[model samples]
Target: MRAVIFGASGLLGRSVVCAFNDMAVTGTCFSRTAGGLVTVDATSADDIERLLSRDQPDVVVNCVGERRPEVWAETPAQARGRNVEAARLIAEGACRYGVRLLHISSDYVFDGKAAPYRPDSLPNPLNAYGRWKLLAEHAVRAACPDAAILRLPVLYGSAQFAAETNLTKIARQVSAGVPMEMDDVCVRYPTHADEAAEVCRRLAGALLRGQRQGAVAHWGAEQGLTKYQMAQLIARRFSLSAGHIRAGEADAASGDRPVDCRLDCHDLPAALGPLRRWLFHTEFPPVVEPWLLPARPVSS
Candidate 1:
C-alpha cells in the first residue's frame, strides 16, 4: 500500500512510518532534517494539496497538529490554523483523491473532570489545545466521513521528547540529578509512540479494506498515571531519589488545563478485536529505562 505521513519527523509520525516500513511510505517533515525525505509545511493548504495530488496515496496518515498547550494558549489563531485548518485541507485532499485518512487526535478533547472517556463521549475541552483538536476532528469528519480518527494520550519515545514532557523527558531530568516537579492534578494515560503506531497501521489497513472505524476509535492503556507517578517510576529506574520530584498542580499560574483526560479503552477492544498495549507502559521505569538512558558514542 502507498502511504503518506505528515509530520513524519516527529516521534509518533516516525513510529508510524517504521511500523509500515514494508509498505511504500512517503513522509513529510517540517523544518527538520529530511534525511532524504519529503519536506512540507503542514499548515500550508497549497503545499498539502499538491503533495496529496502528486502522491495519490492509498492511505494518508496525519500526524501533523499543534500539540503544545502553551502554543495553543499563546497563539490561538495560529494553533487553529495549524491544527484545524490543516486537517480540513488534508481531509479535503483525501476525499478528492478517494484515499483513506488516519488522523491522530488527542485525549485532551475531554474536559478532564471525567476520569475515563469513551469514544462517543461528548467532548468539552477546557484548554485551547483540546478545543482546537476537537475542531480538527469535526473538520475531518465533515470532509471525509470514512476517515479514521485515533485519539491518543501523551506519547513518548526515543525519537521525540524535547518538545513534550513525557516519561523519557522527565526521566532524563532525574537521570541528571536535576530536580523536577510533575503535575499530579492532571491524570493521563501515557502511551508509547510505538504502541500508537501499531494501532494506526492496523486501523489504516482495516479502513483500506472497507471497514469503517465509526466516528472515532481510541487507543490507549487502561491504566492511568499522573506525571508525578511517572517521575517516581523514573527515579526508581535510574536509582535516583524520587524525593526531588514533588507533586504539582497546574493552577491559574500554569494556565487553563483539564484535571484528567484518561480515555476509556473499551471502544478499541470492541472495534479492533482487543486493544494492543505496551509492556513498557505497564512495566514502566524498567522495560523503558534503557531507552531513556543518555546516548553515548559506540565503541569501534
Candidate 2:
C-alpha cells in the first residue's frame, strides 16, 4: 500500500520509512533533507491536504512530536500545536480522503500511579507532554472513527545512533564520565524503533485489509524498568562505572515525567518476551565506543 509518514526525519519516522521500502513511501521532513523526501508545513491543513491529494496514500502514519519534555513544560502552546493540532488535521484529512491513519502515541498518557496499563485503562497524565499526547489521541478519534492508535514506550534503535535517542544519549553521556541523573521513580518499557516500525507496517496492512477498529495497540518490553535501572544496565553493558549513573525521581524539578507509566502489550506474540530481555544488544556498538572513557588506570 502507498503510505505517507509525517515527521519522517526523526528516529521512529525514519525507521517507518525504511520498513516500508517495498511500498510507495513518502516521508515528510521539515528540518533535514533525505533522498526522495518532501517537507510538509505541518501547521497548515491546506498543505497537508495537498500532500494527501498528491500522494494518494492508503495510510498516513504520524510520528511528529514536540519531543522534549522540558520543552513541552516550557512551551505548552507549541506542544499543543504540534502534538495535538497536527494530528487532528492529519486525522481529518485521512477521513476526507477515506484512508486510515496510524498515529504513534506514548505510554506517558497514563499517570505514574498505575503500572502495566492496557489501552482501555483510564489515562491521567501528570505532565504537559502526556496531556498533549492524550489530547491528540482524542482528537484523532473524534476526527476519524476508524483510525488506529499505537501507544509505544521509550523507543531506541541503532538506526539513528548519535542522533539523540534514549539509549544513544544516555550511553554517550555516561560513557564520557559525565554523570547522568535518571528517574528511579518513573518506570517504562524501552522498545526498539525497528520493532515499532514493523508493528506499524503490519497494522497498516491490516488496515488496508479492512481491519480498522480505531483500537489502541500497546507494544513494549514486558519488564517494567525504571530510568535509573536502564541507565545502570547500559553502563554495565559498556563496562562503564555505575557511578556515572545517578538515580533520581521524575518531577517538576527533574523534567516532569510520569511515575509508573509502563505499558501492557495484551498478549501479542511480538510483545516483549516472558524472558524479559533488555531491548538493546548486549554489546556496545562501535559508534558508542568512542564516547566511552579509556579504561581506568590500574594501580599495583
Candidate 3:
C-alpha cells in the first residue's frame, strides 16, 4: 500500500515511515529541504493535491505540529498555520482524492483535570498548541469523516531530526554534565515512537481490511510519570550521574498542563488485541539508562 507522510523527518513520522517499509509501500515526504521528497506546501491544498495525484497513496498521515512551546505565544499565527491550517488542507485533499487520513493529535487537549480521557470527551485545551491541534482535529473530521485521529503524548526515540526530542534533549544535557531541572509535579505518559508507529500501522491495516469509517485511538505508556521521574528513569537507564539533576517548579502558569494526562487504553487494547502486549512489551533500545536518582551526601 502506498502511504504519504507529512512531516516525515519528525520523531513520530520517522517511526510511521519505518514501520511501513516492509509493506508494499511507496513513501513520499513533504518538507522544505526537499531531495527525493516532494516539496509540497503543507498549507496549500493545490500543492497537496498535486503531490497526492503524483503518489496516489492509499493513506495520508498528517504528523505535522509546531513543537516549540516557548515560541508558540509569540507566533500563534505561525503555529496555527502549521498545525491547524495544514491539517485542513490535508483533509480537503484526502476527501478530494478519496484517501483516508490519519491525523496525529496530542494529549494536551484535556485540562489535566481527569486521568485517561475518553475519545468522546469534549476537549478543553489550555495552550495555543493544544487549541490549534484541537481545531485541526475538528477540521479534519469535518472535511473527511474517514480519518483516524490518534491522540497521543510525549513521543521519544533515538532516531531524531535536527531538534532533539524531550527525552533525547534531557539525555544529551545530562550526558554533557549540564544541570537538569525537571518539573516534579506535572505528569505525562511517554510513548515510544516505534511502538506508536506500530499502533498506527495496525490502524491502517485494519482500515485496509475494511472498517474505514474512521476511529479515534489513544496510545501511551501504562504508567503516568512526572518529568522528574522520567528524568530519573532515563538517568538510571543510561547510568548517568544524577547528582546534577534537580527538580524545578512546574510551569503551571504558562499553560494548563494536566497533572495526570494518563490515557486509559482498555478499549484501544481490546481493539488492537494481541498487538497491545507488543506495544507495552516493546523495550526501548538502551540508548540511555532507565531511571536513576542522585545519592544524598552523608555526614559522619
The candidate with the higher TM-score, 1 or 3, is 1
Which portions of model 3 show Cα errors greater than 4 Å? 22-35, 161-163, 253-255, 276-285, 288-300
Report every candidate's CA lDDT.
Answer: 0.78, 0.78, 0.74
The per-candidate count of clashes, in order, stands at 1, 1, 14
lDDT of candidate 2 over 1-300, digit per residue (tens): 789999998889988998888789999987777777888967789989999999999889999887776667687787789899999999999999998889999988887666778889999887777888999999999999899899988877664455366666666666667666777776666777777888888777777777745778887765666757766776777667778667876442455567667777764445322323344544235435545556767678
Q: After superposition, how far is residue 188 of candidate 1 from its true place, in Å?
A: 1.4
Highest lDDT against the true fold, candidate: 1
In the range 241-266, model 1's lDDT, one tens digit per residue, is: 66767687844236567777788767
Per-residue error (Å), model 3, residue 250 = 2.7
Q: Looking at candidate 3, what is the lDDT of residue 216? A: 79
- The TM-score values for the models, in the order shown, are 0.89, 0.88, 0.87
